[model samples]
Target: MSSRSLPTRQLATVLFTDVVDSTRQLAQSGDQVWARLLDALDAVSRSEVRRRGGELVKSTGDGALMLLPSPTAAIECATALHAAAGQLGVTLRIGAHTGEVERRGLDVAGMAVHVAARLMGSAGSGETVVSATVQALASPAAETYDDRGELSLKGVPVPVHAFAIRQASPPPVASAPLPVGDDRDAVTRLLRERRYEEAAEIAPEVDAATLAEALLAAGGRVEFLDVDITLVRMLQDVLDRLPADDAVTRSRTAAKLAFELRGDPSTAQDRRDLLDLATQLAESAGDAQAASEALLATVNSLWEPTGALDRLSAAERVITLTRRTNDVDHELEARLARLHALVEVWRIHDAGLELATYARLAARLDRPELNVFVASRRGMLAQISGRYDEQARQGEIAYTNAVAAGMPDAERLRMSHLFPIERDCGTGPDLFEAGLEMLRELTGIMPGNFYEADVAWVLLTLGRRDEARTELARALPPLLTSSGYRWLFSAVLAAETTAEVGSAEACQRLYDALLPHQDLLACVGPTFGGGVGERLGLLALRLGRTDEALERLARAVGDFDEIAALPWATRARVHLASALRSAGDIEGADSRLAEAKDTARALGMARMLAQIEAEDGGR
Candidate 1:
């Protein structure tokens, strides 16, 4: 500490701007004309830099280097210079990077300066490109940055995540505009109103920007309204018209269309095709961030029984690509996707390990919104390990941090995970009442039969057999199709409900559905109830297969013990006792019951404890 010198480096935003196609312009206009233009551009650059609170370090004949205090200032100066160059009958290609730079006598020297030059070299004609750092530091409203993904600059030591900067305004219309003002607004309003035929009549005449806007507006009404195929086709047509070399625009458009189409079952194949195209375009252009986004969309739409392995593979690819981009936010999303896939395929141990690595990397970002996601995964692990205290703590951190971060979907995001913890170990409200309320709120927000199985289980726990049966009936159909990521856990809850009141046919159907994946843990995102073996055993018991029930239940007991999931272990023992009793082993039955009752009482598992007492009373 004593030997270390005071830090000489200070943070700065370094910017570079060069005349686009200067050589061609020089050859076409002669040296005198080009020289005069350069002089005027240099004067304009210096003036703009001073106006935006920056220092024009020096001119490089055809370009200039500048130092600014902030990314926003740098971008404003760049935008101003671009306009000024336009007046002088020239165009510009600009780049910016925000990082620590060493001041060198009215100049700057560091990786930041070098990286800015590299970025400028990568910029297309009339475009301003910035490193991910600059994009992150600048206000989002300062400019419109189209992510160009991870680019391999010629002299840069590492790949950089770059974005092309545009002014914060509506996308420019095509060279030949169709309708203007009120006329264009009419078509947009028609599209939003779901008048597909009327909108489609004018869609062919509309510009790409207008069509994209209408499509997004229509897509956002997915829950209450349906997206017309005509609208999708219109946007696709515009995307097709884009130049083949415009990979960034193409990839982004395709990805956006695919995402919006996800809620439409009829567009399953369309979504797949669009996502594939997006990935191909991005990859061919060496745009890692765009590729990562396309792959993430694919993984998010996965629901088929055989898709887990594919999902894991895709998620890993996304992580690799996003890491190259050096975009922490996207990388975090990719890693979380990978974590979910690992859990889905029953690689719980691997998921736990990866989560640890994810946590360490996320800590450096200091983003509370990201922290909420990390905490939720940790809570899931805690649930599996029967560490209810830790689970509750993590849940609180996630909820509080989500609120603190002003995450709009904070409640919806954490509700499903939090409900389970509250149901199992909360000291606040009556478990059943609070659980029912939370489920209702979640249903209101997400709608569908998404929570019907959960509702049925809660009802069954409350001894409302008739109501549980009704909800269970509503919940069964989605099990046969794609119910998204929560299918396995929903199946688990449905299986538990079926054990009590289901017909032999229903039990057999669920058994067939669950038996194929007996090796995987039955969990939904971060919520683990128990192993699949126990669920299978319970269904077997309901089907009167006592011998198979005994075998499966015994295995489930061992599984619970191995994981130290106290609540699940206790419940498994209770089920094992019933199986043993059915098999007519009185001593074995009583011993298992005694062990289960002890754990239930100590853990304050009132529902399970009541079940044990009820069984004892019947005996």
Candidate 2:
């Protein structure tokens, strides 16, 4: 009944070789000349294959695929082919990989063949790219290699570590004195002690490769120590002197420097530029893992809602490419980047699917860092879905894991999510206050204003309007041009707090700034909460725009009710009641207030219930 044929499998080393910029060459040379040149190139390729004991599968116009007995033979043949092609005035880009392939008569098929083709595409003219398997099988003396790092080949489900086969090995360097073998630890300790000039001077005494590694490690440690600008500059100077072809070192250094710059709001544009540059370098070197990392950095820096879809698309590409390479850590990170973009665009279902994949990968990889990150994301998702109990449980797990891993920053981030969950779950303000203290400690240690917006929200809710206003001032400047979860949350908090404590002119300015983004929803958990519209309504009411206030608050109540966010819906109803009273609908106001009170009582939202009672008493 089945018309499909099963593929016959065989282990072989697949090699793909192609002419670089063939189209451009074709355009420059007429059809006849190009045809003759390709013919000559094919003749040389066939001769090399026969001489090196390989079976030529087929010619793909300007490229050819060959099957060799072993990876060693494949590299040998490729090297000879490179030399022969050069002699014929044809520059060739070659790629080789050893894996199980499907032998279908004269042609071979399978991921191994495809991966080789992709690697060839990634190679430059006169260069040969090979997978880790090829590198492992080949005799080291026969071919020197430059480790290319991990690459996500097209149609591959995982990342592959590749190496560029050098034509010859370099001459050995004269042995150095000054304990070069033990310099890595010394450099690390000096960097840790903040002795930047001393570390910089000592780093160069070791070999270039070893020094690059030391700089990358030292740079990461310095980032945790409050982002020393002077030290970053020193590291950059060292990296700049290294070989341009050293992509792995360059990509890692660029990514680390970008992260350090991101901590300072003043360097936002620099951070963006550096990340984009890093992406280009990674792509040029065919380092998909590094490319994905750069893209994730770009996603983190993107604050505009208009760019969300573009960033999401880039993240998806990285995810697909990372998955093809079978790199668990990078794949999980790419998935998380995609998930963040999904959540920003209010695509909850897609985000959930990504989370599921992330969880599976984290478990399979047995990476504690991944587990802690997954737990943090799961806790955030649970909070959005109104599963406060699950949120609290996951939050605790994330916190414990973070602490055990010595990731203080991750612990602080989880605390940020936990504070809101505690409030919504009807946990007392004492715990919320404790969470704030932890956040304050983190801010003191890190010296960043990211926590100020969260601090403002808690202060406003506790009725410390003056303190909330101060915190809002500190949080608002950098967030003015930004959009997304944190930016939206900050805007909502500023709008509500300003309406209560700031001057009418200041409140109106905040209102005007927020009006354009009124349609953007605040992501609380699994659902879009009423925070944005409700705060907008309250600000409008304060500005004597009763009609606008009622309109916005009504929409807010509907959205909250649709998601079954009882506490949020209750808060929206209370605001709607006040807006109604301002519009001279006393009876409607009474009805809305009564409904809000009942919902608050049913949900055991003590803070919300108290607010409703206070509003009623004021009326």
Candidate 3:
């Protein structure tokens, strides 16, 4: 009977680890030193194997075998095993293969057994090898692996894309480089082997200069939002480090990558980074087309609930970007020109005053589009301020022109904003409702993100969370999944509906998701949805994250102050004050509560006054 002829049966991720140059190390050190090193390794491997939910199967005198349940668990085990034996110069190389194996006596064996041993032969010391099958099982959530493109193995008729588990710093490597130029006929062979670090080295040597655009086009084939973002940022940093005029294509690449990344529901830093890179790239390229696209990309990132309105600075930066370019007459320059015009004149002053200035400017410019945009924002300011009559008039103009101009999305939104004001003032009431039904049709035709978040805001205010949730589900089309504050839409859905539906679970999950994403939202609306922070904070307080609740509620006050949402501001202050009191600062809390009552009274928010009274009474 052969010593290798043993078999063991178990469900496991089969693993292979080998130390490189073991015979040479033995030749350099005496027998006693080698024996002690082997003893140290056995002890280290045993402890680490147990720590990683692995069991030591058997010791092969020098190499030991281990088993673990999942590929992730196996990789984790192997990483720990490699570290534990590092100090003794016993450089451990491991290959993991997971499958059903036959068990006989104390030994384990299967077809994967040969494969794992063969893979271990391929790896240098201080390395771990994993198969492509294992990589597929780890997908997006598992945080480690460096692709070693493809390699051919002895007795394996097929090739494979192998991998090494990555660390913050990998061990120093001495290994053969993978040969260049992958043959199309070797797809199976490619799938079975890896030339990981070699490919990255060979990539730069490929004279990308000769095939720049083709390489870019190939790179563009990478479409995952997160991956594109990382590539874009790297491209940006690379371009920035190089002297200007060194290569125009570098900036173009940066712009392309950044623009693509911005389309993801990624981090604000990611979106903002991409936009900034795109703008800088455009400036570098001296290309009008790229500049216009980058500017629009920047604007697109800003159309979310500012809950703080900080992104208005970004929108304003686009205006500044528009001015820096030589191509002021670029066909796509209109949006920036209009945005700059609005920013110069149409922030949060009194609606009546802003309207007169907007009306004068529209007449001076003789532009209907400018008139519609400015009139709509001012009118929204009026309605939320409860200046009912002025709200009605601007709503009429914005909706009427949008219809005449064939801007149905704008028309639907304008009419939607008008409805509550009409209901309040007892005028054009049916028209607003008719406009909403019309919006359901418009939602299907609009070619953009979350035109429905806009529609839902009105629906939420109308006390229609159930109906709004249904419409919102319908309204949030594929394009809108990439929309800014998408997480906020779901949060608003819970915040708006939870009080009525009594679903604590939905509200809690919604709150949890929203709180993390909230740090970067910059609201652009004229509504006190910013005050929704107080509502959310109060919920968090009930959930026992009182410190978080207090911090969030205070931030809400800052947004309210900027937008002059006094009534909502006062309401937010009361909630925050109550939270502060609950958190043990009684004097500070009392002063805030008093100030809230005064502001709510002056702003004529009887609802807020009643709420403050209840809070004070509770205390």
Which structure among the candidates has the greatest TM-score? 1
> Weakest 10 consecutive residues, lDDT, candidate 3?
1-10
What local lDDT does model 2 show for residue 493?
Answer: 65
Runs of candidate 3 exceeding 4 Å displacement:
1-249, 263-296, 301-318, 324-366, 420-490, 516-528, 541-563, 570-619
| Candidates ranked, most accurate by lDDT first | 1, 2, 3
C-alpha lDDT of all candidate models, in order: 0.69, 0.64, 0.51
How many clashing residue pairs appear in each of the predictions shown?
Answer: 0, 13, 32
lDDT of candidate 2 over 29-78, digit per residue (tens): 96556655665565566566666556776666577788886667787778
Error at 127, model 3, angstroms = 66
Q: Which portions of model 1 miss their true places by more than 4 Å?
A: 1-194, 199-221, 224-277, 304-306, 406-429, 477-482, 508-519, 547-555, 558-566, 585-606, 616-619
Q: What's the residue-level lDDT of 58 in candidate 1?
A: 60
Q: TM-score of predicted model 2?
A: 0.55
Off by over 4 Å in 2: 1-281, 303-307, 368-371, 399-418, 425-428, 466-488, 512-533, 561-566, 594-602
RMSD of each: 16.4, 19.4, 23.7
Give the per-residue lDDT digits (tens) of candidate 1, residues 506-614: 8999999888768667555456756777899999999999999999989888877875677888888989998888888888989999999998778766656778888
Which lDDT tens digits does candidate 3 get at residues 490-567? 344345444334345544754654554454322233221333455577667766688988888898777667766555
- Candidate 1 lDDT at 110 equals 49
